[model samples]
Every structure is written in C-alpha cells, then in structure tokens.
Target chain A: MTDTEPRKESVSCPMDFILRMLMGPWTTYILYNLKTHGPQRFGELKRRVAGISAKMLTERLRTLEGAGLLRRDYEATIPPKVTYSLTKRGHELDGVLGSLAEVGARWEAEDAAARSQRAAESKSAELRAAE
Target chain B: MTDTEPRKESVSCPMDFILRMLMGPWTTYILYNLKTHGPQRFGELKRRVAGISAKMLTERLRTLEGAGLLRRDYEATIPPKVTYSLTKRGHELDGVLGSLAEVGARWEAEDAAARSQRAAESKSAELRAAE
Candidate 1:
C-alpha cells in the first residue's frame, strides 16, 4: 500500500504488522540461528541462542509456529526427538536477515573504531594534563 | 563476520548488534516515518506515527539521535521549530525497511484471503447442518 493511503491506527498497516511479528525479544535471533544452522532441537536452539531462558525460547517458538513462519517436527523415538526449522515462509526472510547482518557488521565495526579513537583521545588528554 | 566464526556471547556478533539497535519498540516505525515523509517537525512526526505518546516519541527520537541515525535541526523562533530527518547512516536502513514492508504487505494479503476462505467454509458447513 502506498503511503498516501490513510494510515490505520492498527496493525492493518503492512509495516505495523511486520514490526509486531519481528519485534519480540530474541525473535529475529531465533530465526537467524535456524536459518543459518538449519533445523535444531530445542536444547540445541537454546544453547545456540545463548542467554535465552528455556521458557522464553518455548514461547517464541510457539509464536513463530502459530504465525506459520517455522515448522516443528516430532519423532516418537527413544528420547522423543523434536526439531525446529524455517518453513518455506520463514525462509522468505532471508533477504531481510541478510541485510540486517550486513548493516550490523558494518555499523559494529564503525562503532568499535569510534570507541578506540575516543579512548586514544582521552588518554592523550590525560597525558597533556600531567605535563 | 561469517557464522562459522565462533559466536560471541555479546553484541559483537553482527546480527546481535543490529537486532539490539532495531528491536526497541517503535524504533523502526519512527525511522520508516522519517524516511517516507522526509524531514518533519516534532509535532508532525508525533501525529504521523499514530498512537505514540509524546514521551515515547521524544525518547525514541533521542535514542535515534544518540545513535547518529537521525539529525535534529532546531530553528530558534517563537514556536521553536525542530525538524528530524534520517541521517546517512539511517538512510542505510532503506533496504532493510523496504524488505520488511514488502514481506508484511504480502503476508497481510495472504492472511486476509485465508480468513475469507475460513469464513466461507464455516458458512457452508452451517448451511449443510440446516439442510
């Protein structure tokens, strides 16, 4: 929809809907991990995500599944194996994820460089004060 | 950095860094609004964003400014005009935002279609029961 269209105060606006989908904590990260590493078991995903509580992971997974973004496969094996992977629809986020990564890398590097420069400047100022 | 590279437990990872930047509430919305509408004074922006409180808008605007993603221009006058626009760094998010909008619009349309079909199916089932 064009911007000229009267903006709705609800998620009916395309941008608003997508933002709500992706805005949850650890949502995009979960998608990225699955996309990059392929299907993963619950434990494996939790480890890969790092710092995500088991409960949070389960909740996010269910949300994604409910939205039809990912698939959950079940196996009635010895330990009852279950795996999560991006569905065809979830994979559709490849471009958006890629862009985020590329831009993130670039910005992160720039921020680091700026930090280093600031540190060096402060150190020199300290030296000048001592003299 | 390649995913094969060992992941850090911090925002050093490219995806993590960018996600942290964008994951805040109403952040992308604010950026999207600025990009589409060009420079806008604070009052106009508060209106266009829809449902954003003046306090939240001010906070998000400050955060964006702090990150160097947007510029705030001030005109010293009776009303104290202040305009906000995306900086070069913020403009870099154009591709990311565009992808989200496209994906969101497509999904929204699909969702609408699915809802309609479900309604039709339920109606048919009800008619069958009546017969």
Candidate 2:
C-alpha cells in the first residue's frame, strides 16, 4: 500500500485521530482553560496557560479552531476584541479530560510516594555506612 | 516567578502530565494495540503498529514503562522473549480512550459529510457556469 493508506486508516480510527489532535503541544492546556474558566480573551489565555508564548498560543488556538474543538469570536468593538470558547465538540471532551485528570492525580501521588521511598532508602544506606 | 516555577506547577496538574505523556508519537498506537489485542511481544508490536520505526517503538515503550503506564515482562524462553502489557494505571485510561473514540467517530462522519457537500457545491457551480 502507499504511504497515504496508513494515514487514511488513522483518520478512520477514532482513537488515532483523537490522540493525534491531543498530541499537539498546548492543545489540552487551551482546552483545559476553556473548560475550567469559560470563554477567555487572547491575553487572558496567554496569562492563565502559564509559560506559553503568545505565538504558540495563537498557533494552538488556530489548530483547535480548525479541529472544530473551539471557536474564536471577534467582537466588533474598538480594537476588535476576540474571545475563545469551546464548541460542542470540544465540550464533548469533558469525560475524557475528567478521566485524564483522575489518572494524573494518581500519577502525582505515586510519584511523590516513590520520591519519599527513594529518599528514605538513601538515608538508611547512609546510616548503615556510618555504622 | 522563575521559568522553572510554571514547569513545577505543570507537574502538579494531572491533565498536563497525561497530555504530555500522550503527546509522544506512537504512544497511543502502542497502547491501542495492547489494549485491543492483549499483551504483545516486541516483534508483534512492530508489525502491528504500522509505519513506526523499531527505534521509535522501543523509545515509546520505555517512556510508557517509566510512566508506570505499562509493564515489560521478560520471558526466559529460547531467544529471550519480551512482552508488554498495560499496567493498572494504563488500563485506567479506558474511560478516556472510550470517550475519545466516540468523538473521533463523530469527527470522521462530519468530515466525510463536509467533503461530499463541498463536492456537490462544486458540481452545481460548474453546471451553472456551463449554462
């Protein structure tokens, strides 16, 4: 088969498409902000997303809009105010995002526990060396 | 705050961590295969994932293993067989994956419909021009 064949198959596979969409850097962060804080302006997103550059934020918003996950509304006001909000398809991701949040919380807890365990083991080894 | 501060905050956010992990290429493909087909050997995965390089697959597996999302088992058989399977935490992603699949399917259907609609519009425009 041609190289395009596998990519075509990926489009047909729902999991693959979703995974690819989320694979983009800042995609989920933007989505999370919209979900948690509701519609936000460009500057507001840039500030709340934490550490994302304006250029990257703009690119991510465009990508999200293209994917039909979010919408950009430009108000006909002075300076043309723009706000970003989730589309119905984006809101449909709530279940998935919620599940990810649950798993993420577990990962954090496990990571902390592992770190403490390692520290304890190292401390004990030091004690043994002294003894 | 320092640049590192936001990075530190990202570690605490479960959604961010999960998104980062899933962001890696071949991660979801490998996970999808394992989830659908049960445990898989290295060779099996390489063949089944479709278009992934051996090096990339190995790297993705290592990343998944490090994240506690999958377990790599070494079987002491002739030629030394290694199998990979999802861990409890990895399996915990079922809900998220399921939701993603649902959305993905909807996306594909919408995309196909849009393509056909465009095609029909083009055809009518051509007819009008000919008239």
Question: List-wise, what DockQ does each model earn?
Answer: 0.44, 0.58
Tens digits of per-residue lDDT, candidate 1, A60-80, equal: 999999989999999999999
TM-score of chain B of 1: 0.83
- The value of fnat for model 1 is 0.48
Q: How much is B95 displaced in model 2, in angstroms?
A: 2.2
Instruction: List model 2 lDDT by residue over A56-82, tens digit each.
Output: 999889988988899999999998899
Q: List where candidate 2 sits over 4 angstroms from the true fold.
A: A1-12, A113-131, B1-12, B124-131
Q: Name the top DockQ candidate.
A: 2
Predicted candidate 2 versus true structure: per-residue lDDT over B1-131, tens digit per residue:
55654563652356877888887867878888889899999999998988889999999999999988999999899999999999998898877887788878878889999999999999999999999
Worst 10 residues of 2 chain A by lDDT: A4-13
Clashing pairs in 1: none
Candidate 1 backbone overlaps, count = 0
Give per-residue lDDT, candidate 1, residue B127.
100
TM-score of chain A of 2: 0.84
